[model samples]
Target: MPWSPALKSTLRSGLHLERTVTEPFQVLRGMLGVAIVLFGALALGETGLATSAALGAFIAGTASYQRSFRPRPVLALYAAAGLSASSFVGYLASPWPPLYVVVLGLWAFTAGLAWALGQTAGVVASTTVSVMLIVVTLPENVPEALEHAGVIALGGVVQATLAAIWPGRRWGARRDALADAYASLAHYARRLRHDPFASFDPDPLMNARRAAELTPAQARRRPSELAGMRSYAERIRPVLAAMADPRVGAAEEGPQRDRARELMGAAAEILDAIARSIRSGRPAPIAERTYRALTVPGSGPVLDGAGRQAALRLIGLLAEASDAVEAVDRGDPVHGEANAPGHLSRPGLRQLLPVLPHALRRHWNWSSPVLRHAVRVGVVAAVGEILGRSLPFQHGYWAPMTAVMVMRPDFSQTYARGVARLAGTVLGVVVATGIIRLTHPSAWICAGLAVVSIGGAYLLMRTGYAAMSTCITGYVVFLLAMGGEANTSTVEDRVLLTLLGGLLALIAYAVFPTWQTVRLPDRLAAYVEAGGRYSAAAVDAYAEPTEHSRALLRAALLEHRQTRAELLTASEQAAGEPVRHRGLHTAQLADARSAMAALGRTTMLMEAHLPPPQSSPVPGAAEFAEVLREQTAAAARAIRADEPVDLHALRDHYEQWAQWLPTPAADPADEPGGAADLVYRDAGLLVEALEGLDSALNS
Candidate 1:
């Protein structure tokens, strides 16, 4: 295949139109919000009010994809507050030139600070910024501002009501998510059966996990179903990977291999059936044949202890997956484990006050990317605003708005997005003009098109910002036409202003840049630290059995998983970034990734071997747990400080735990019946896993 510049760009940015629609319901829900606003505003036949309402719709609509575990009413209230606040700020500042620039700049800064919260918050903040740009330009008088405010408020209320009424296929999202989870397992199983050495991509599994994560507890098919689905998904990946171990594969290639392969094939079929059932929104009976296959005794190859253990783990995971599906179908609580409680609760006015100082301190420091980006945005937005007002371009808000949207925290992202933004705007303008000239649509048609474009914009948001920008530009064109003010000249102005704004954004980022390549090590260190804490928690849970200890283990595990996911995502971003004047050592980065993967496998095995809380643990278990904690902490510190980790010391220290393992001649009757045996087995597994992780890191 010949490589073109466009192809290179697409590959570098991971762009593909197929991903434009992540969730069909999210797009439809947002479109419904816009449609409602358009319907209400068009019925009134007031252009000014319609314009204000349309802006409000777009603001609220863009946030339709923000998912939370919170109740609908709570989330709606939060959305309404954000809409009202952005509208008010924009309206209050437009009359005075200096105040307009200063306030808009400050708003940009505050929106930038929203990145501290997470991706969803960042999306909401960006939408609010765009809303401010539109609302502030709607006349200057006090009466006009008040009227616009009223209309905007009405629009927001309409959106909130619509969201509550039709929240877009709740069951569909859960169904798709659960199906995807099963499909991923099936795919992995097939691959392992084909070739033991073949690697699997984690993205599909991660996406499945993300889908389940966003699903609200009440919205799920069964109690704790989403959580159970995610847990099973996590456990299955490592177990499959373990089953693919070359030693296990090489040990039995005749009858034993055939039997193992047959079971895997059956498991895959069962998973596919479950996925199909979920997709069809029906409860399908578990296949009796598949269950029997798992239940049948091992009649094949003799195996070493390690191979036997791997085979046992694979069967156990398959059974676990089967149980999860049955539990979902029965509408029973899956796994019987309580889902983790909310990490960050919805904040009230009083709650905000206590955390204001801490939030400020956390986000206003030099080490904070959000703080640095906020300052960059503030300065550049002020310049863009001044330029927009100085230039005699009509609808001058485009320049400042474009600048606000294009500028990102890092230089690479900002520059790449700026290029894409400029290109997309030009293309969108041309396309919109052509459509208008050919169709000559009426106001109602224009209104409908505007809503459709808004939906497309959000649908493509994740694939690439440039694609989203193209849809948004068309949305703006149609929206203006709905207000009876679009023309060929309008397209020209939009294209020119967008280019200018994009250029400004690129220059601004160049002037004050934050490079991800430099920050990757720190992020990797954070992942290491989180992993260590999680390992300690897992070990401690065994040392003492209590509800509190279990909760801590869950929390630690969740935190570490999140951090590891973050590291993986950041690695991709850094890898794709244009490498000019950067310290992105490819070899080192690969090592980091490999180490993380190894650590993940170890964590999975540890979780699998985790024992129920015991009345008393082995005396040496505490010492082994300490070894893991100290070793992992040391590795994190070494990575952060750019020092080489000494795996020899870690290995030497962990060797003492080898005594806990059962000897070849040992019998089960010789050990304590329950707690002591469980403790010994868990401790041994944890120690060995830690050693494997340590070796991977050192390598």
Candidate 2:
């Protein structure tokens, strides 16, 4: 169809609006960075000040805004480190000579400390770069490089201060994030209600990601990083319990709709808590409490007699699961909280040692290997940079950037990184070379490009390590040209260096021979254990399970959901692991997801007919676990292809397990019939191990 005059006008209007939106932040940040560069030589961190200023201008948009001003202390600590290190370290090593190299151990020590302290990435980069730039490595042009570092550090400080002062600018974005995340949750819950069969869909992360992605605007709007809330899914059942069960929701409002409403409400509240904490810059105590509550059977009373029996029985099941989650959280080496409290008491090396008992620690997945890989990256980066400087290639030293990109978890990442490095370098070098070759742009132009590189730096961040390098290259190229290095030969050198950097990155990645396979199973098991502990808390509460147990469970569940996210990251990383481990990884992942669902389902059943806390043993609560454990044993045997589980053995264990909770009244007319018509559902998935080999297995 032919375009109409109206359409043309609309298109133009849209373009203008888009351009207007993009210009200010981008332009201002660039200008600020350039100004900082000019100032830092005199003032200590000119670039940092500029970068921080430019970043701070959009202060309203940080994750903290959602919390109503509460910031995550963890991230805050990092910013503090970043800001202080500039001043503290700058003073310590002044008049830093150009082309100097830091000792290997010092760089490793700094980088390792950051990783040890829980900064997995950006901080690690900062620390290594700090060592290379500030400690040992310096520029061919000392004055200019020092000027740049000072400006960068200055930009960072200004940005940090600005963000702390005003969070409202980013409040809307934070709010959007909460809204979108919940909206996705609601959609999924609704789907589950409509088609429980959808559980057969093996790839939940994909589904969740898809659901979130479909509403791009909403996903983008979430204020909390939430970091792949797989554990949070455990809480959904409790939220569902509050919604679906009459006692939890409006009693007279009717069960069908009220359950969903209450569940959605609880979820919203939790999300709100997250948002509120982020925006306010305060931690969400309620979020932590409510999340913990998710592990236990909800406090709703058991329904009419028969339903009540089922609910009571389920209570026992869920409580056992709660115990498992608790096991993971408290003193279990797997989750590492055991070492947290004792950190100050022990030697650092001892503290780093695995604290979980052997049995508990056996459930290892590669994801637990955070510290090791971080050290690897730091060591490699420092070593490669030192090597690069010594190389005969007087023109280009590309290894440091390569080391940064390749250092993460694996090698599958290397090729793309290589490509990105090469591409970004060439692009940046060309941009730098041309400007210097052509007529000079104003100081404004120079400053503006510098600032634009910051945004480009953030945008291209995950895209490639070379992106940051590119921006720096562009700035350097512009500086070179400004100094009249505009000759054809200079342009040739620029291209050559850029190419060499790309090549060097590839070499570093390859030489390291990293692989993608992440230790997913180990991570998955940790989540399972956490989930199990949460589940057991409900059961163990006996008659008077306190809110404390409930709170603990919720946190455990929350922790579990967080792992669900890492599981996905591991899946990507797993591409390089040996084939044998991959299957185990998959099984473990499946087990975790399944265990979470089963655990939640029990909580839901309990919510349907909650018994008073520990109102007597209520019959077969004792045997319930025997049944579940038996089932698990059976399943294990099945995996081994051992002799079949003995029918007699299975039946006996089932009977005992089946005996949990009070039995329903014989006559409907005599009492409220609790689930008499419903078929019995086991609270936990049962695995049947071969009875014949039981003795042999023990041996």
Candidate 3:
């Protein structure tokens, strides 16, 4: 955790270029919008207006590439509106240097706080800050400023229009998300065949759930193949785990275990087939051997109890998948239930207006990283502007603009981005300036070159921030050249200004840091609380088998998955911090993570054997479930308070519940495979997991 090592790590991360799956058609489509705005402005003989409109279109196009489930056109429009408003206000205040500085600080602060909404919103809002700085220097009067703002807004309109009319693949992102979930299941199944207790990553399922959210109109027009499929994928996961687990399904090594392995292998193939079909929007071509393996024969080795149940459930799920694929091929309206547990409802753009204030208010606290980041951005931006103006640079606004664009809430990102931005600016300025001096291209040729640079930027957006920044620098250089600003001094000014801006941003974060290490305990407590809810919900379902209980269990499971993901992400980010905290040593954190995983896996095993509707309720389960929830909630609080995590009450309640239940029959044939028996057996494992957690925390 030394500063030297941490800095080296962050720099490597910054310079690393990722190999992403590039969609050429989509990149070209986004570029078309920029080309239209630029060329149209050039035809009208307004170079200044052309630059403003192209900048707007380029930023809006970049917003569409962000990882969001919302419609691309809507994102474009939102970015456009922010850009237009920021540009107008910047021009209005440019006459008074003091007033403009205040406005710039306030605007940067608001843009930073926009992270409360999401990363997409934050990035788009930050672009508005840059636009305000860049475009304010162009307009000479009120009428011309209005004209520039209108043209910039028009650029967004063009991008939105193109997105709506020329969507490359309808429902493509959603299809890929769902496909990835099934693909993950296939990989899990394969892994389980070799390692019975393998852990599954829930990220693909989470992405699929997000993709499933739709506006009312989208929901109505959704494809039949997409309906009810995600629910099937979700249900298949726990069952797969149940079958492979030695405790719940087959013994360690026997005929039953071999049969379980075969079934799992077959299931993996079927899942892969379904994934391929879903991704391609074609009929699933299942293999004959896979079907034969799943089909029950009269004389094959018998899978009793939980193993038997899991096999039957998996077969039914596979049938449902096959039928859905056939329905897609036949072009039939398969009226299967589309509602899944923990499904989210996304409101339309207009509906988001009323809730925007509430969303912003939620992050208006000292503890919130977003608020701290906003303050840092505001102060740094104002200081950067002041320093830039004090210097002898021709375009002083470049310095503040760079600071606003590169700054993030965390240390790693702010430093990494600062490094990348500086390096990229140097590379871009050298290459672009060299080209202009060598070719001495006309204004029209410079405009064309700017268009090409924008296209390269769009294409390399996912590669790395550094590569994209290089392209962006070239694009800006060419655009400015078209306005007759391409002199030898331009390169020196741009590179030095960018370096100054990046250093200011980095220094501000170092002074006012928001370390993820400090928040680790809170994130761990959240995971513990969510795990408790999941365990309680699973237990409660045994006490009363109803649709309501099922829904609660599903919701709890989703919450637990989300919390686990958050904890893991926080841990990764915290790893690179220069400061080392005192609480929770490395071993203790690992033990805590292992204990939580064990707890969730045990609860999932119980969930796999949930009773059917109208089944008799298990005795004493309701009281035990209540006790489990209360003890876990209290333990979470203790963890957050740095107190011992005592779970004696939960363990005591479980012991009493076990005593109240009737003893299992000695003969294996006489043993019941009902919900009551399964609940009794799994509750002991749940208590053990809780005890493990208690020990990990108290240690």
Q: If scored against the real structure, what TM-score would every candidate get?
A: 0.82, 0.59, 0.97
**What is the alpha-carbon lDDT of model 1 when measured against the actual structure?**
0.65
Question: Candidate 2: lDDT over CA atoms?
Answer: 0.40
lDDT of 2 at 181: 45
lDDT of 3 by residue, 254-363 (tens): 88889999899999998998898888888778889988989887863367777777778888888887787678888786343335332457788778888889977898
Residue-level lDDT of model 1, residues 630-649, one tens digit each, is: 87788778877767765455
How displaced is residue 186 in candidate 3, in Å? 0.8
Q: Best-fitting candidate, measured by lDDT?
A: 3
- Give model 3's clash tally: 0
lDDT score, residue 126, model 1?
62
Clashing pairs in 1: none
TM-score of 2: 0.59
Per-residue accuracy of model 2 over 343-421 as CA lDDT, tens digit each: 1122232433554234124323333343445445555655655665665543333445444543434443444445555
Model 1, position 680: C-alpha lDDT score: 44
Candidate 2: count the clashes.
Answer: 117
Show where candidate 3 strays beyond 4 Å: 299-301, 334-344, 665-676
